[model samples]
Target: MLASWQMREGFLRSGRMATRRGVWVVALALGLAAGASAGEEFEGKLTFEVVSKQAGAQPVAMDYTVKKGLVRMDTKVAGMSNYTIIDPAHKKMSMVMPAQKMVMEMAIGSVEPPAPATAPEIVKTDKTERVTFNVVDATTLTLVKEGEAAGAGAKTYEGQQYAVKVGDRNSEQWIAKDLTLLAGFVETFKAMAQGPNAAWMKRVEWPGFPYRMVTKDAEGNVLSEMTLVAIDTKSPDDTLFTVPDDYKKMTMPQAPPAMPKE
Candidate 1:
């Protein structure tokens, strides 16, 4: 079986954002807000053709299927590998890594909010990074931030910035100036901080990674971009979020020594 690091590395190397969950939320919210004539629940399939390329490697094509609250990812890597099942409501995820011939399960839980800090303390932290939220009229919000990082400390403010705490990660978010959150930094950061299978928090702050995303269309026109995707809703269904009863389950032991990073 592939080591944890190996799996993570493979994901990173794929050149696709790992925050599929966040993207799903933002996409759904936006798609619904735009597509829906009135406030209503939406249920449909979203298909995206993922094209990836790495130095000295041939381009790779993959198909992604996302329903209301479920996702099934299929990739044509080494062997017909498939990644199925992500249920945030139940805090469970399943994966089928064909290259490693393994089926794995992971347990997850929702994040709780942090206690409020006093003004003096907030002012001190404001010198570095700070988050705030504000209401723009009645149907919109604004989140803003200004400063640098100071270790892993977190704070929340009310203005153009919003800071939400998710799990052990605190994400500082800045909402879009005009388009609410459908197309802005808040959606982008949310996607990066949380993976596709996790729940979304009102606000959060997390250590940023040293990577960026660039999106383009067939005509090479620069378009929307983000680091990962996040899905912040209940699980889709029992069958979609679990391993098939008929499939054989396998577990592999960890290697004695870790492989050196490439």
Candidate 2:
């Protein structure tokens, strides 16, 4: 684990731009958090700007709108504009490329994510006050990855993966039970290292979202981070989830490698 952390530290210190492409690895269902709470369900938009320090990496600003099982993400990257609509109810994701005037369709494996452990084993580590543009909410709890201490054998858990070369993963997040997004996000991902290429991948019993998440190499150097900029529960336009009449249907340019006929 020491060697792995050292390598990851070097990587982060180098700021290689190639890794920035992973910004899109967020959950296929970022907006799906059903059965979370009685009053938590509502439609609204979340706008965030993802900035990377990696060389040649261009910052991206995107908006996510959610209504029930539908989600629309409009993105602008490197002067190019495009978007995707994820329909969990039908297990379909639409990729709209305006330059090509085409809409690509792909099927997702699941819409209803695996429910998080009802009695998740929780181990608290640290706590501190967190702020968002002066909206302070200090009810914070930092979680620890049970078992597999640093310099020990590999950390084992369900769906753990290390793509583009693996590295030591020691993560902690500030969780709030009110958000109901942090736990589900963890349970939904790493169901096989499929944690959307982002470091916000660890699962715990916290019932809320993390306004601040920090992942470290074995040595604890910051790798990547995700900050919740805003949350609005107002319902969004229904049309955002629908493909336009003028869009031409096309097969996804890159499909998940087909399962072998076993």
Alpha-carbon RMSD of each model = 15.1, 14.5
lDDT of 2 by residue, 1-262 (tens): 9976765454343222211221232243533543223334435666555555456878776666667756677777799877777765676667776665656666555222233323222335445442323221232222222341333222111221111212444555555544443343333223212332232233333345444455456676656554445544456778778888897675432323211110
lDDT of model 2 at position 118: 31
Badly placed stretches (over 4 Å) of model 2 are 1-40, 111-123, 133-167, 177-203, 253-262
Model 1 agreement with the true structure over 1-262: per-residue lDDT tens digits: 5677686566444313223332343332332333233433333222222233433543233333334444454444444446644444454445565454445554433332223231111111232323333443333223332353323222233223333343333333333233322231332223322231123322323233212233334444433323222222232344554565655353222211111111
What lDDT does each candidate get? 0.34, 0.46
> What's each prediction's clash count?
27, 7
Question: For candidate 1, what is the lDDT?
Answer: 0.34
* Per-model TM-score versus the true fold: 0.34, 0.58
Residue 75 C-alpha lDDT in model 2: 74
lDDT of 1 at 191: 32
Best by TM-score: 2
- Residue 199 of model 1 has an lDDT of 34
